[model samples]
Every structure is written in structure tokens, then in C-alpha cells.
Target: MKGTIHKCLAALVKEEYGEDAWKKCLQSSGFEPERNFALTEDIEEENSINLIVESAKVLDIPLKKLFDQFGVYWCCTYAPKHYSFWYVGMKDAKAFIIKLDEIHGLVGKHFNNAKPPRFLYHWTDKNQKVLKVEYQSNRKLIDLYISLVNGLAIYFKEEIEINKISEHEVELTFDY
Candidate 1:
């Protein structure tokens, strides 16, 4: 996991739930109340999971709800503001999704011990409206991935019908 993720999660919690809640969440997760994660720093996977679980617990929300909210905040607000270069020529959700794997690869190059998820895509329909995306990651954060896709739809102001094909696959039908 990357510290950037932790940083974004912290920001989301502080902005939406207030600083006190964020501090409590961090303390409950076995972290110092004032701990800060550097954007490019490496974070332990277990610690990241613990932080997420504790955040949900502290906020009195379901884990999936937290994931959903974080995904939207990361995709639409945090990433765009912090990594504007990544969105240089992105026109829509489809364009961004198609380039996600490549973008991750580029991101990995800048960080030590980075192991971002890999995405493989195939068009299911002749007209290319439906896309089947295969997600590969040791972390198994499929719910978060699905939420991020939903966030992409919201970010682009596009209607996307998403179907979970399996634990590691999804079918996205785009309305264009």
C-alpha cells in the first residue's frame, strides 16, 4: 500500500467527519493521533486495512460505505487536485479507465516497492459499449475497485451499468 492512499483517507475523514473523528479513528487503528503519511511513502498492508476498518468503526458506517465514499473522494477530488498531470488529456471515464493500467505502471516507477493492481480490458460488444475488466491484485480489494469504478462514472457524469462477473472481474456497460 502507498501512503498516498492513507493520506487521502485521512483527508476524507477529517473533511467529512471532522478532525476529532479522524484523530479517534487513527488512535483506534493503533496509530498516533497526529501521524501523517507522506504521499510516496510505503505503508504496510495490514496497517492500511486496519486504518480502513477503524475508520468505518469510528464513523459508525459500514465498511462498504466508507470504501464508496473514499473511492469517490479519491477519484474525483483528491487525485485530480494532487496529480493533475495524470489527467492531462483524459476526456472521459472510458479514456481514463482504458489507461489505468499504464498509469499505474507509471506511478509504480516513481515509488519504491510499489505493487499497484493490474487491469486487463476487453470489449464485450461489437459496438464497444460494454467492457469486461479483469482486476489482478494480491490485496483483494475488489469492493474498493468497484467503488472506484462507480466514482469514475460520477466523475465523468456518465451512466455506467456495472455487473460483477466474479470476485476479480467486472463488466461495465457504458452509455454513450
Candidate 2:
């Protein structure tokens, strides 16, 4: 599932931002843009999104500002049996939730077969910040995950699903 989401995000960004432009954006935003496991430059799965999110928390910056620093914007489509994009901004969790609800309605109305709802957002836990969201469906749940990666460019952050005790329930912890 993770690999598929990675591929989908790659494809979409290539289509939207161009490969070279996207790579430059990632680099300028302080991501390695390469595969390495043990450094902040590397985005190994466990450390990938959470690392960036934590940086944002420390610096008191919004994800969108980070992406803006890199000169990028994005758009994607949800297709048959597959939802294609997710994005996160730093401020106003409420507005973001409204947008997600609007997306859910749009996709549900268009597809005629509503999949389960998936959410992505930041929250505070015990005076510490965590970013998270969830989606469940037949396809790989790529939309939210890809949005998460893109969100990292903006949020400069990382997040993880700390618990998934059932098919329908997920608990995530973010580090930004």
C-alpha cells in the first residue's frame, strides 16, 4: 500500500509539477530527495513525514509557508475506485476539515459508491503536537497518504499511524 501510494504521488507530481521542479522543491525544503535511512535528509518511512512535522513544530511555521518557500502548488484527481490526492496546510484545522468534508461529498456524489471516510489533520496531545488523518477503502488509500507527503513539503513534518486495531479504525501520531 505504501509503495503504491508513493508511486501514485510520484506520478501525480510529475504530471503536475514536472520531475525536475518537484525534485528541486523537495531539496529546497530540506528533504534529501534521495533514499537514505538515518539522517534528517533521508525520508525513511518511519522517520519521513514525522521528521518534517517535528521541524515545523519547533520552528513555529505552517506547512503551506514551507511549500511556498519552495515555489510549488498542486492538484490531483480521484478516479474510479481510487482517490488520488490529499493536502495539508498549517493553520486552521477547521477549514481543512471543511474542505475534506466537501471532498467527501464531491467524491461520493460522483462515484455513486461511497467509500469510507479518510481524514488528515493536526492535533495537540498533552501539549505536544501530532498530525494525523485516516481513510479506508478497496484501493490503497493513496489520496490521504500522498496528501501527507505533499503536506510535508508544506508542513515540513512527519506523521505515523500509531494504532490500527481494526479494519476501520486508525490512530496516528504526528511529529510537527
Candidate 3:
């Protein structure tokens, strides 16, 4: 799975960088600002994979974890092979991620590890829910979320569809 490590990219310049700095660097790097996160014109060659792998290394984000977090497929102008970059939303995923980590310190601890379990403990409208996800080694967190919702549908005996996925999380609605 291919994904960009924004923190690593931000660290490419300075220490103690804030949100604006991150956006600036990404923008300067030719990354287009999507609604939530930024998107860069990806080049689809072997080098793309190399870049993602190297970024993961620089960020100290375990390769396995990187794969787990953003292994989704994407199309880039440079490469037609259908490669991957970090899948973020219209919002800054990092900020909410930091908050999630704060709320569930365990998430950060496990996320930093390569072999962390595929489980997300979060609040659904103030109610706690446990999500057991599959080994989406190369998919976006949103994709994983969609898959989780699919699974939950079966568990709850209801039908649902995912409307949007933000950097913080995904939005889902059920139709009766």
C-alpha cells in the first residue's frame, strides 16, 4: 500500500511546525488542496512507492502501520499503474488524530507499532462502539470504515451507506 506521511513531509522542513506550515509545505510541493486534506499530483512509477516507503521511514511510522493506514489505490498523472498516496479527507486528519490519540492513548501506542490490531474504539454520537475491521493492508481508513459499516449492518440487521469520510472519521446514514 502506498501513502504519504504528512508529518514526515512537514518535518522535512522544520520542527514544532503548526497546521499552516504543513499546508504551506504541501501546497508548495504541488499538492492540491482538497476539502479536508491536500492532494498532490502523484507520479505513478516505481519511485512513487519508493517515496511513500521513504516517507514512512522518516516519520518513524512503521511500514506495516503505514500500509494499514493508507494502502488505498489512486490514479496519478505520472503513473497509470494506479498507485497509492495517503488518503486523507477534506479536513486535516492529523488534528483529529491527535485528539483521538489523546482520548484513546491506546490508539497512538498501537498505531505506532507495526503489528497493531485492527480495532477502533470510538464514540458514535456519544455512544461507545467497537469496530472490528479486516486486514485492509492497502486501503484508506475511510475504506476501512465503509467496510466496518458493512459488517455492522449485518450485525445490527440494518442497511446503511457511507456518505463521506473526513480526516477525523467517516459519516454514515441509514435508510429505512
Name the top TM-score candidate. 1
TM-score of each: 0.97, 0.31, 0.25
lDDT of 2 by residue, 34-129 (tens): 622321121335343443444334345675453333222322232212433344342433344336646765655655334435554445476444
Collision pairs in model 3: 4-86, 35-90, 36-89, 36-90, 36-91, 37-89, 44-79, 71-138, 71-139
- Of the two candidates 1 and 2, the one with more favorable TM-score, higher being better, is 1
Scored by lDDT, model 1 comes in at 0.92
Off by over 4 Å in 3: 1-107, 110-139, 165-169
Which model scores highest in lDDT?
1
lDDT of 1 by residue, 1-176 (tens): 88999999999999999999999999999999999999989888899989999899999999999999998999999999998898898899999999999988887787788899989999988988999999989888888999998888888898889898888999999887
Q: Write one digit per residue (lDDT tens) for candidate 3, span 65-171.
A: 54433322111111113221222331332222223323224533534332222434343443322222222223244443454344334433555555544433454
